[model samples]
Target: MSGANEEPDIPDLPAADPLPRSRWRMQLVWLVPIVAILIGGWLAVKAVMERGENITISFKTGEGLEAGKTRLKFKDVDIGVVETVMLAPDHKHVLAKAEVARDVAGLLVDNTRFWVVRPRISGGTVSGLGTLLSGSYVDVDVGNAAKARRDFVGLEEPPVFASDVPGREFILKSAGLGSLDVGSPVYFRRLQVGQIASYQLDPDGKGVTLKVFVNAPYDRFVKTDTRFWHASGFNMAFDSNGVRIETQSIVSVIVGGIAFESPPDSVEEADAAANTQFELYPTRTDAMKQHDRIIDKYVVNFADSVRGLVVGAPVDFRGIEIGRVTAIHTRFDAQRHSFSIPVEIEIYPERFTSRYQDGRTGGRISDDPRGIANYLVDNGFRFQLRNGNLLTGQLYLALDYFPDAARAKINWDKSPPELPAVPRTLQSLQDSVTRLLVKLNSIPFEGLGNDARTTLRTANALLSQLDTEVVPRAHDTLTSAQTMLDSANTALQPDSALQQSTADAMQELTRTAASLRTLADYLSRHPEALVRGKSGDKP
Candidate 1:
């Protein structure tokens, strides 16, 4: 019976030849993981593409830059990472391989500069790490300047600001540059508007070419008549009366700066003509024209004019500093017997014209040169000496204003007189001393020595009379007088025995004479009494 029931089991296996599975089952099994892997790979490829940029940077110092750890940023946003670092063949620089994200590609302009922005201190500002880290680099600025596509170099300092701000370029020539320095502020009426960008030697190497930047609105203030000067450092001074301008602070930041001085009365003219045509010159051009209409009526050689004037002397027109002598050099003039000296001078004609001009007046000297000429004529336009520093004998040219009557006639036919020149300051005193020695050589020292010898002889004779003849005679006379006084004192003594004896002898003589007179009276009748009385008296 159980076999009969179980018979169906064999039949059941054959009956279920049922629905056949699809042939694509094996393919489906293989496809799931493959699809997933493909998707994952595509995503990864996209990520890499988005995160990558190929770039190379050169560095002189690799102190803080690190491979794989360093990042490139655009406006504080991380855009790339340093992939590799290799030393250049010359070992002078390090080449940094970096990969930047594709999103930031457009921001890399032709002028884009890639510099390692590390922490630094400048102009009282602390940047980059903010004292948090030492060696980390921040993406610094590259000027929008066009450059070739190649490896970029990192700068040590980040630029303070964009350059080529619309303005005029002024050129200043100086011997020592005084207190002028780069990054010094430029002030207009004591308000800062610009700064010194950079400096270099002029092409001729005779002067310095300063690249100064003047910002926006203030740039317009610089005009054809604008005057620039150095305003820096301490200039403490005092007069003989003890009144002084003393500097008491050291931390003070009165740094070197530039200033503009314009004619006060021409304010309206300057404003109106501020938009006139102008040009940018890397160096100062001799564009200022002299009053050509006025002929060079008198051409006086510098040496002749200053022959008698010392270095610190005044070249005055009624005691005014029309100009200053910057330097003096000699060149032989074959045509003439003397050497022609070229004297470089600087003049400030502001005060001379400032008082006479008004807002409507154009900046022309010819308009009112009569006053200047008259002043010069009245003052004799002469040179006089002045002491820049008493101790150093440093001299400077000063302008002295004097009445016409006090003026001395200058002889143009004769050579200029040789004048004493002092140092301009203590530092230049050595130069004055050197020149003084040269002039001192011309003094008659031999004659002075002879005069000194004669004076010594007279002094010696007077001393000898006082010491030997006069002193000895006074001593002998005093001794003789002392001796006579001593003898008189002894004779006047009341207790002397000789004095008592003399008194007694006088009494005896008186008694004897009385007795002789009495005997004479008795012998009146006879003369025999006188002789007899004397003989009896002796017995």
Candidate 2:
């Protein structure tokens, strides 16, 4: 009964309420909320798909850091954003949490460098001026490695060169870091081709090792025999060649720089590989010197003073440089009771290759070094100190043949070997002057002067004697001779009696000679008259 009552009531009520057919299309008012929900779903999906990695960067300080504000940029283009900045656990630095775009995943590799961008003046370069207007930002330099890392150490200073600056790296070892720094320029023929990337003391603490990057095209110019030197400031040298000064450029002088050059005369060699190690010479002269392969060290004992000789003084064969003086030492000879100067010379035997070509072929000059040494000594080869520059008083060593020099031999048994040395030309001259002075000192000049005075006195006395004695006698004798001559003149007078008597005697002698001449003629006419003679004459 209850069912019948409830059914009838329900059917009537349903029929009455037969509620108008529900519309198939939603209302315009509802469309607004539906569209908003759809848009919200689309945004959620997009965010999920485009989500980026969260990276942590440790910085020494967060001077200009601001969460949700700073951005990571590359080439002035934003690549990431800083989400948060907090103090590190150690409190020694600040940790920056950043969100980087997924597209730059390849850039987040090992060696990727990051630093803050702000107005900076460093190493003579002004950078990040735009950061002043746009506010500070995080800068990144993607590295060239395969490994990737999310945690990074932020750099305090900006990198010297970005990866976009195509170049090759090289290593240079120097005795000391003169004026070189990270931003110092590298010059190839005075053109800025690169810069010093970094520098550090050697592990041994004996020298400095510098990393340098040579820009692409210029890197090819570096050869296996390339030489590097400090081209900054003044490259001054004072020696036999006199004073010399050299500099790459005014900029280099102000900021310091490195210069590299390959010897023009050197053989064509392959380009140096990346990260090649080279020696950084103090000056270009030392860098350009030909490398000597064969060095023969020998000691030369000098009796003369080496006042002007220096360690780097060149040792020449005749006029050709073959070596240099490496060191000089003084020794006391107990046996001889004298101090001797021993000069240690470094001789590059290879320097004589062009001259003594026979040595190369192993002929009379054998490859055995002692053989050459013996031959040289036997042929009167000796070492002599020479004045290289008169103004600088620089002395060098000269090797030449001296046939008249005292005989000597090389003592090969001694360490470094021993060679004979002659006195320097100046020392020899000084010694000669000293000997002359000694001889002059030995000469009895006072005695000579006294003898000269006595001789003058004797000469005066002799002159006086001659004037008082011989001169008057000679005059008297001359007068007597004049009288005799006068008498002879009187006897010879034409009107004198002796003259008349002489004429009569001459007439009688003439008659006698005429009669004798006639008798001789009669005898010559008649040969029989010789015996019958003058029979008529005899009768």
Using lDDT as the measure, which candidate wins? 2
Colliding pairs, model 2: 532-535
Candidate with maximal TM-score: 2
| Candidate 2 lDDT by residue in tens digits, 1-539 | 78766744444343355567776967789989999999999999999779887899999999879999999998878888999999999999999999999888779989999999899865456788987788999999989899999999998878789977878899999999987888789999889999999889999999999999999899999998899999878777788999988789987788788999998776758999999999999888889987776688999999988889999899999789989999999999999899999999998876766544643521222468898888888888999988899899888999998887788888989999999988866777899999999999999999999999999999999999999999999999999999999999998999988899999999999999999999888778877886676665754
How accurate locally is residue 517 in candidate 1, as Cα lDDT from 0 to 100? 93
lDDT of each: 0.57, 0.88
lDDT for model 2, on a 0 to 1 scale?
Answer: 0.88
Return the TM-score for each candidate structure.
Answer: 0.51, 0.77
* lDDT measured at residue 385 in model 2 versus the true structure, 0 to 100: 86
**Model 1, TM vs. native:** 0.51
Candidate 1 at 263: error in angstroms?
A: 5.8
Evaluated at residue 188, the lDDT of candidate 1 is: 72
TM-score of 2: 0.77
